[model samples]
Target: MEMSEIQAARLLLGGDGRAGQAASRQVGQESASVRYGEVKSVDAEAGTMTVLLDGQSQEITLTDSTASTRLKAGDRVKIVKQGQSWVIDLAGGISRALDTAVSEANARMGAHDETMAQQQAAIEAAQAELAGMDRKISDAVDTAISQLETPDGGNHIYAGADEPTPPKDGLKAGDLWYQTNASGQIAAVKVWNGTVWNGYDMVANSILVAGSVGSTLIADGAVTTAKITAKAITADQIAANTITGAEIRADSVDVNEIASGDIYCKRLTATDGAGYTEMTGNKLEMLDSGSRSLVAIWVEGGVCYINANLAEKISIGTNSGSVLNISNGGFIFSSMMPGFRVNGVSAVESFAIAPGSATESFSANVPYSPHKTSYAVVYYRCTYTDTAGSVKFPITEGGSANVVLKELTAFEAADESIALGCAENITVALGNSPNKTFAITRGNPYRFAIKPSGNSVNANPGSQFEITQVTLCGQ
Candidate 1:
């Protein structure tokens, strides 16, 4: 993340500001700079952590216990100046692009494994149905072979000459030439050799019918994929759950073989999309590589939660386009930013002075609306210590970045008409405008200051004019 982009960054680097001049470190104060990094490793015993900053690894000590508790490897942290020394803290709002990329790769591999399992199950079912058909074909082949005769080099169909006609439905008499058994029976009469026989014999003009195709006729391992017609076996031929995991070969099925359908998986990833979708805790979530929600939908107890995530802003509208857009810049509706009059004023900035001492003269950040609302009132309460004078606040731009500035903005609160008197236990509400609402920008924090309105500070540096509370009102 860029240092300049960090909202929490307090910098004193010698970079040219919006103004021509850059701020320099003043005497007797430590200069500081803010930078971001990823934690590589943490050693609580050693009081240090190895961090990757700007593509380089560097070791930094953990001086703050709070920061140490929040840090771990793969987490990002920022090195910032705190008081007199540099300290490490978790970096808020910094981009974690590297970690997100790694997550996406892992998700893709998981999806691949799940897809392979489903394909294997489907292919195995087809193999079982193929085996069943092999039994039926074998029996038909054997019946023809037994009736073969000489003069045919290989088996061929029999001719009508001296050949018995085939049966219509079942085996019958007169379909073949029969010789008398050892018992010496008459022509076309029943006869038996040794085995027990049923009382039946061949009759005239009757035909022999083929018997059931027996499993014993077919040799094991005779049928294979080469013997079957392509696409002949379908789902109807294969029984459900007939194929088990043991019947499948490793990596036998691939994506090319699978037809388009719904894929159910624990984790599904697509590299082209750079994200993953998964089910967790009964909620289905689709997330980007960064783990930020891209889109999600789930139902529980008749209630559904649908989520779509966008950075910094969200818009809602019809098919035409967006009618309402909510962002850090504030709500913009149909090409217009919402406007409220001064009567709708609210506190935009507020801070308390020390119990007895006033806050030091420094450039602290103040909230400003992107729509450029105007501030109108300066309010404060001070208990007087026999002191009588007014302290008007004059806010300005281009304040120094130092923790303490030796000079102040040219405008004094006195230069403006508004006056805040130093009276005991009294509250003051002075109308401050024209100067209070200075140069502004959208969606950014501006720098405001508290300093002497003249000799009010250098002469009376005690609780005589100490502010109990102060608030900046904007509309």
Candidate 2:
């Protein structure tokens, strides 16, 4: 058994039981010694080395078999204590220390290489990603260039700038180009028409040359009246019947423009024998030189006829007889009037009235004056009930029963007292029964009245009467 140096030293210094036992068990044994330190300095001739041990300086002697000559400052060495002296251990000394250090250095170098390899791989991946990004950027730039530049047709698609000059080569038909002229000025744009280049003038205020007016060049409503010369539109310029009545402005067409035979009328005079002949010319002259009268002239049978009076009688329709005539005053018809015309002042009394049990009279106020000589006719229509035994009669003042003829002067007369009678000169009848209408010569009363016969009539009190119409007329 051998005692380690630490145990022997502890026992020699009066150590505890564990160290004392270790020394006692190997009292005769040699002490095993080993120490490790970095060599601080070395003396080959003296076979001694100054070493740093546990942060303290120590001098150790090398044995005859030790390689102390190979030791240098900063070298790590393992030493053993022998007989109160320290010496490098040959079995596990600087060689073993160098070997352990080499192994550790190799491991660190291996770790550093792995880290470098990882970094290299990361850089390569980043480069590849950057390459892809560059390719995308290049593609985007190419696409942008394609959009901005002209196409194969060599036409400049962009506007509001100077046109491209000389154009791109290999241009097809309809390719447009622009270039400086001989005067070194930008010339008109030219279009390639396969065989030749045709200049297209886009200058403002340029006049359209002859044969240049095409349908595509003219917009609707582009041609206005101001653009046309006076009388430039002739009869041939207008399509047949295209000008409707509404399109013709009022008084725009002169009389000279109207054809004479186009004025068709059934009559032109008031007299039956006097009528217009057929118009022969295309012109009608209406001239009034003097202030006396206005005249209308027409052409018939190559003869011009003039008429100053348009109101003469004329035959119309298939009758060849005078059906209508117009005088200076008005119109007259030989037969019945064409339409009912209001003759004179008229009034309507359309109110319901209840007559008394006794005979009573009803009259309409006349607003018109009587004719001095000629007879004025009064027209009236009334509705009333005639009792079974009652006798009703229309009458005027100052007339006898059923036989009076002269006109009455009184405006109002009693019904029962003055039993006036119908005028003999005037015709009276119970037209349409219970509704009577009659005409009488006008007199002073200027009002019409209806009365029941006082002597023989027994009027019904509940009988209702109404005067619907009254009119007066005179020649």
Give the runs in model 2 whose Cα sits over 4 Å from its true position. Answer: 1-35, 50-68, 80-92, 149-475
- For model 1, which pairs clash? 167-208, 170-209, 171-209, 384-423, 384-424
Tell me model 1's lDDT, rounded to 2 decimals: 0.42
Candidate 1 C-alpha lDDT tens digits along 398-447: 22111111112333455453223332222222222333322111121122
Task: Estimate, for each residue in 1-475, the C-alpha lDDT of model 2 and write its tens digit.
Answer: 3345564344332333254364454432333355566777777777656555433332333333345577778877666666775566655764787799899999999999999999999999999999999999967754453334355644432211244334346545655554455553545657666767677545433344355463223334343221333744555244343343433544233333544445555323323333333333554433232222344566768987655564354323336453543334333332332212223322111121222211223333332323211111222221232211112233332222232222222224554433222222223221122233333322211123344442333232221322222222222
Candidate 1, residue 214: Cα displacement in angstroms equals 27
RMSD of 2: 31.5
Assess candidate 2 and give its TM-score to the true structure.
Answer: 0.25
TM-score of each: 0.21, 0.25
User: Against the unseen true structure, what C-alpha lDDT does each candidate score?
Assistant: 0.42, 0.42
| Candidate 2 lDDT score relative to the true structure | 0.42
Residue 439 in model 1: lDDT? 19
Off by over 4 Å in 1: 1-36, 40-50, 55-62, 69-102, 109-111, 114-129, 132-136, 139-142, 145-475
Q: What is the lDDT of residue 57 in candidate 1?
A: 32
